[model samples]
Target: TMDIRKNKIREAVQTFENLEHRMEPVATVRGVDFVNDSKATNVNSTWYALESMTKPTILVLGGVDKGNDYSLIKDLVEEKVKAIVCMGTDNSKIHEAFDGVVKLVDTANAQDAVQASFSLASPGDVVLLSPACASFDLFKNYEDRGKQFKDAVKSL
Candidate 1:
């Protein structure tokens, strides 16, 4: 079992390494780079996005939990995050995790959330909408949530 776990971790790590190589262009873009990583849904994926940011980052994090641990991104949150936008039914976890660490706000839907995140972002800042949980609290799925985020970016 332990060997299987190690192999799984190795494979996932390799996949993410590949992802990181491909994601540099997307993550490094100047201006408000709205990253709709709504499919992240877990603490690990959120940490990856936070680690990859090349600019001041406003991370949109929240939604129905498949059980999310806010601790994984703590160091990165303190380092890279300018603000946190909670886009979910309840924002308690997000607020609790980042209360004294950074500015926090809550928005119910995609459009308002994007607008609010954009407001917090400067021209070179990155707006990362990595929910670190499920999207059923608002939109249909991660794709729906991602598309809405893109549309909102276009509107901006």
Candidate 2:
């Protein structure tokens, strides 16, 4: 009985998918991968997402600012991100943080953000939605934000 249970546990672990809104892969459209990490509503979470990136990234960032300090991810953004699509009500802070470091575009919604990020991407590049701020400003929640991102990617 113990052996059977252990094997089942191992199988479950092997088959387990990442949680929704947390490093979820939405789709790959025209060779560009789209990832939804909308659960990353803090600098540290976004940092981990950026740290794991292996390809050039067009990052979709922003939402409801919770007094987030962009400096924490500045170096990582400079290193891994090729462009930034700001999705939020107020994006002046995002622009201020990433303007000279990378190309920045402002967007007010998920579809626009995804489209802008896609436009900035090339083959083998990734469009990552790892907003380091709360989603209340534009979305009901992180899951809602992630769902919108997925839907937009599917539409492409």
Candidate 3:
């Protein structure tokens, strides 16, 4: 039954525009792409997001700790991530996970995180907000988090 829908789904997807947030390209400042992937509420989802990155990335992560095992994206972070900006109330786990693997920094909110990511990025780099945890710790929901990300990018 699922397979029967494949062709139809493929056709629809081929014509579909990316929805706001969830890897949506918010803006391009200089040569950097600011992507809002605030819908990533789990490590697996973040893994996919990181895997899709073509240029060096400054990954903005953090939110409510979900007992996420960072090892799932360790190698991806190590290889593609140039720096990390933590935007949760608590970021100990984020530090522990990427301390030595990449440059890690903390931010009080999405705006701060976006600014920090921009500072860490260069031309041809990307700032990705693919938080691997829930948005409740920082915003009303994933949409709220994504909106903040977009607003910050627009400000820059």
lDDT of 2 by residue, 1-156 (tens): 999999999887756546788888889999999999999999899999999999999999999989988999999998999999999999888888887899999998999999889888999999999999999999899989999999999998
Q: In model 1, what lDDT does residue 140 have?
A: 86
Which candidate number has the best TM-score? 3
For residues 1-156, could you state the per-residue lDDT of candidate 3 as single tens digits?
Answer: 888799889877765437676678888998889999998999998999999999999999999988999999999999999999999999999998888889999998988999999989999999999999999987999999999889989998
Candidate 2 residue pairs in backbone clash: none
Stretches > 4 Å off in candidate 2? 1-17
In order, candidate lDDTs are 0.80, 0.92, 0.91
State in Å the error of residue 156, model 2.
Answer: 0.7
Pitting candidate 2 against candidate 3, the one with the higher TM-score is 3
Q: Residue by residue across 1-156, what tens digits does model 1's lDDT show?
A: 999999999999888655421232233333667666766778887888788888898888888977677988999999999999989998888887789999999899888888898888888888888888888989888778877777777776
**Cα displacement (Å) at residue 112, model 2:** 0.5
TM-score of each: 0.80, 0.91, 0.91
Question: Sort by TM-score, best first: what order?
Answer: 3, 2, 1
Clashes of 2: 0
